[model samples]
Target: MTSSLQAALDPSAIAVIGASENPDKIGGRPLLYLSMFGFRGEVWPVNPKRDEVQGRRTVPRLSALSRAPDLAIIAVPGEAAVAALDECGEVGVKVAIMMASGFGETADPAAQAAERAMVARARARGVRMIGPNSQGLANFGTGAVPSFSSMFLEVPPQDGPVGIVSQSGAMSVVPYGLLRGRGIGVRHTHATGNDADVTVCELAAAVAADPALKLLLLYLESIPDPHHLAEAAAIARDRGLPIVALKSGRTAAGQAAAQSHTGALANEDRLVDAFLERHGIWRADDTTDLVAAAELYLKGWRPGGRRMVAISNSGATCVMAADAASAAGLDLTP
Candidate 1:
């Protein structure tokens, strides 16, 4: 059965565990974002220290909630993360996000073990986990800004046709920041940190179902579930939507960094190249390359012919345009 990313991606209600009042902090940022971004759902902020967070009244703890929320954000410290998961599962919460780090990514035996335990507990309770060391997730469609990313703070979120799902938190919003800077609006931007449960591929498949999303971008350190990703690619292809992938681990250095960050084993680089092409997904090198061709794709310009001709009054403009076309893999007649 395909795992529907409904609960995690667009929850009806959210429980912010370890919620805070400070907008800069991890717990508090989501509260502020949900408020400012116009999330039309119930937000229960769990923290005993405050009566309210970002103007939303705090609920003291998850147990005191009147009803079980669809999703839980574990913004508590590493020590309190798993315990918070247990409580969320008891309340029938379907998805929980562990935004805290020091899990398997730490490479320490205890940290790895802790990550394993967290996954196991979630499995037993039938609750899906998002990350152990993640930046969190954001859905502009639902205004579910459960992420603590400072990127959204710097660059305001605008709903549009692009969907971003990445293995790295930085990779997720960096492209969003770029797109917004270029006046391109993005609908979904998600970071599947550690990939403990909800993988980038699985989440991508879910977001691909959105009728409004015209372009889907993925940033991967490892291909955890190729079969699932294949399904997502197929869906996007059927809808005439395009998927672009930025698969890291190209060199020993990037591979080592990916391993330390996500605990993901590096797949062979050439194989990854073939995999992306075989699935109709264009492979990108960096954040810039990932969103570089985005505006062109969004313009809905269907090519009439493979012929290339540049027309401009200024010779300088024609030469510059020709160089850019060649760089972007577009045919240009010299």
Candidate 2:
């Protein structure tokens, strides 16, 4: 496992820079999540104005923290993200997840330059940055919810075998909400908004290491590193772990939209489809399709033969199931 990803995934302590008092605010939500989700490690809230953030004592600034944290979540605006990271670096923080959204998403030349500068600074300081506009990461098993997504409030987290990684915050949790609604437990649901440093593929590979993970769900707007992604898929396949992916931007309009959203070039739909198929990964059209086969994937079942039979007491049900089977590419033979 890479050192950076290891730090992001299993940090011993976390600092919420720009921490707020309100639980709903971006600055305060991580603290709220860590508390609600039962994170046991020390949580330092870095806020100058507040004495305490959500009952946890405030450290006023990153340097004031008693000890350097393994992971830091910068919740300030895009303009101040770099400065916040600078402090994190001074404190020797290993990884910083920037939750602000203005760096590269605007497609502006200066903003793009700022995004590069952020990455450059992180490297110089020996700290890894996850996203310039990321929603943050979640580990339900450890209760390390380093995100502000309200999905957890709506859909309670469970320590199951499912892992989720996405390029968009909404896309990441939307699928999570649906999968949870269907009674599936998820262990990791991570959103790499801009993916300035930690690409979705890298994070996916890290989560694949969990022995408990049976299924990995990915929602990507771009294929930043296909070689690594294919390698990750190969590893999962070897372990009998199925990877289901929803790579958006199928149409020209969708491609443009995705490009603007993530500030990256979208891979051609046909090529992405081919890549996934070659890697033994299933391609999903939407959230529903992405997780529909989830239960089946968890079952760890494979057909011995193509020939099959549909048995139902009701003639109508039999006909419907037979139609579904045909749609699923199963051959019905006597």
Q: What clash count goes with each model?
A: 0, 0
Which tens-of-lDDT digit does each residue in 1-334 have in candidate 1?
A: 2342698878899999989888889888988888988989999999988888777788877889999898899999877888998888788888888898888887699989988887888788888888878788899988998999999989988999999999899999999999999999999999989998888898899989899999999999999899889999999988989888889989999899999998888889988888888898889878788889798788877678766889889999998988888876788887
Which stretches of candidate 2 lie above 4 Å from their native place?
305-334
Question: Pairing residues by index, what is the TM-score of model 1?
Answer: 0.90
For residues 1-334, what per-residue lDDT tens digits would candidate 2 score against the true structure? 6877887887889999999998899998898899999998888998888888788889888887778999999999966778998888887999999988877878789988999987888889899888878889999988889999999998888888899999999988888888888888999999988888888988888888788899999998989899878877978977888999998888889888987887767788889988998998899888888889788888989879877887768888878878878977888763
Regions of model 1 farther than 4 Å from truth: 1-4, 302-334
Q: Any idea how many clashes model 1 has?
A: 0
Global lDDT scores for all candidate models: 0.88, 0.87
**Sequence-dependent TM-score of model 2:** 0.92
lDDT assessment of candidate 1: 0.88
